[model samples]
Target: MVRALSFCAASPPAAGPHRIGAGRSSEVFAEGPDRVVKLYRQPFEPEAVVNELAASRLAHGFGLPVPEAFGIVGRAGRTGILFVRLDGAPMTVRYAYNPLGLLPALRRVARIQHAIHACPAPGLPSQHARLRHQIEGARVPEPLRRAALAALDRLPVGDRLCHGDVHPGNVIATGAGLHLIDWQKASAGDPAADVARSELMLRYGRLGPAWFSRLFPVRMARRLIAAWYVASYRAASGLPNEAIAAWRLPVAVSRLFGRPSDTDAELLAAIAALARQRPDSESASLFSGPGRSPGRGQPECCR
Candidate 1:
């Protein structure tokens, strides 16, 4: 494995390497006084990095609060990029303790969403086309896949920029302003679909419980939220053989059966009520019983 410190040190000693953090695909290294380097892992596409860099540029053109992309580096199968270091703490640590902070956080997220949706760009992919491709390739059950495709077909299509992933972790509340990072999955699409995806991510990841409560109190219809959750997962994580498939459908159904939302209240109550009336079905057991490893019959990404 190529280590961050070794690579950073070799590149330019004048800019000393400083330990930052690493994720599944890359490790961050302090490259300059105000910039960081993202060293990509093996098999991670250089095109993805280039695409994200282009997106960051596009975001900057729109005057959105996003990190400045310095440039990208590639050599001997290794790839990396330089970005302006956002000078702010992750909102996650702060929000966990003060749940009341979720409202403001969500409002900020919504405003960002509004900004992106207002952007005008051409040659963007259609939500229906993308969702259809995903469902066809996704490793979900045929029935569930069909259901998701049907739902996707009903969604409105528009020419708006979508962050694709807008959870709190990607947002940095800085002294200057809130900056968004990670643009590899961005595309132009409907704002509601984007908002729905964020809402689902927040609800399913248990990231915005407080904000959700504040936005849609106990009196709102919960069915709409459940529908939004399922639709978002179907659209975003429908990689045919991805590990996300194992949890996507189940999690979507969970939102319908577990929580109550103003948007999806009726649907949630109906699903949960039906579940309560019937005994647990053993149909899914075949996928879990003897001869099956934890990931057997599931996507390879799970293993």
Candidate 2:
């Protein structure tokens, strides 16, 4: 488990660490009343961190609601970023009981998505390409790797900034409107594919389907929210093995069945029926593949 850094009120802001949130590369902390800090513990692609910070600033510049930047706190070697802390309850907690509120909340999400999708993404494509590019180095079993590669090849030609993790947890209900947090996974890529991720996560995360279904239009629902979405969606190299598989059928099934979406049920039944024809060994093999990364795997459906 990760340790929380010590927070010393009397010490200088850089003299101590305060835990806020942890991701693969960095830990967020409160530097003071007005500033939050991100300290990178491990060697990270500095450009990636710069990209996220720049993306956040760009979003703010575009008149999109997001946290304000304070400046860099630590040096380039031991990285840390400072930003103006925003206040609000995470939409995740709010939606836990009052699922009905999701509709209004999702409208806010849709607006954010629309704004980011409309932004020009030239330097950002490499980050997304890393995500969409197939993993060919490992000794992946035959057919499954083929399927993943096929999925990679079929990805649509798209150019837009994608908030790769667009779940409710990343959104906050601040007074200025919804504020987006955690820009770590933001990238430039296909907009619909990003929408597909939101659909899958909402369904698989067991957040339910009512609000999600309301937001997606017919084209997004059919093209970006269905089987096509799963087939073409990218999986980053660092994604855990479980997260990779979950992105495919099982999670998609959970999304479909959990919401009790007619489209999802039909899609689930079709996938299951197809799976039944494969040899038992081959069927079991689907559960393991090159896509699995080494970390906490995502659940097919989370409570």
Candidate 3:
């Protein structure tokens, strides 16, 4: 999982390497009071390390709120990236313990996303290409995939930077400010599409237990948060709902691949229904649900 870590300044720099946090791709360790090492898990490729390193440096150059990636190293057959550490709690974790903070947390993340979109993106890959790749590879029905792909081609292309995955889990609320992590999925694309992807992550991305989301209250909370996040983001960016809605089909299909968690039953049922209708048809209004957007990088969901 993406983690928001807190570090103590009093800790000596000479302290030995200790585990701090772990995610699907790598395990993080505290290298010192100001630095951490993100060591990729075994059986992974060096390309991932190269992608993340390049992405991080690009983000840093753009003046986004991201940790500085120092360099890459190999240790015990695992590749790692040395990064300047930030001290904070993940906005999701904080809101989980206290639901009252959810709205403000959502607003904070939305604002950060707007800022990220404001930056010029010259060196990133095409978000359109990434979306097409994921949608094509999804295990959905052939007809459904074709419809989504067709709709994607008809959608507008944009020139903004998109943090392909920017759910609360990737947003860390640190003392300095709200710092975002996990840039492996960062790409150049439409801000509206990026916002849609963020909404999908908040809606369907696994939070606690798979069963926990089945509860009425849990689902309700997710629904509200997703709605408000989109609303706030829309207000800030002036992106139309129709623009965001147009991307929902292919984005939803893209979620089916490279995800580690069990697929939610609600999502499957929704996709099954939408598969029967043309994405641009009025009948496809069923996709107005508050989830879905394109995927990027290994482990598509970027959880």
Best by lDDT: 3
Q: For each candidate, how many residue pairs have backbone atoms clashing (under 3 Å)? A: 16, 3, 1
TM per candidate comes to: 0.61, 0.59, 0.85
Candidate 3 total steric clashes: 1
* Deviation of model 1 at 205, angstroms: 3.1
Alpha-carbon shift of residue 170 in model 3 (angstroms): 0.8
lDDT of 2 by residue, 201-237 (tens): 5443332344654345632433332232222222211
Best by TM-score: 3
Candidate rank order under TM-score = 3, 1, 2
Please write out the lDDT profile of model 3 over residues 214-241, one tens digit for every residue.
7888777777778888877766666656
- Candidate 1 lDDT (Cα, whole model)? 0.52
Q: List where candidate 1 sits over 4 angstroms from the true fold.
A: 1-17, 75-77, 123-127, 206-303
Candidate 3 least-lDDT 10 residues: 294-303
- Error (Å) of candidate 1 at residue 59 is 0.7
For candidate 3, give the lDDT: 0.72
The lowest-lDDT stretch of 10 consecutive residues in candidate 1 is 285-294
Please provide the root mean square deviation of candidate 2 (C-alpha atoms, Å).
Answer: 13.5
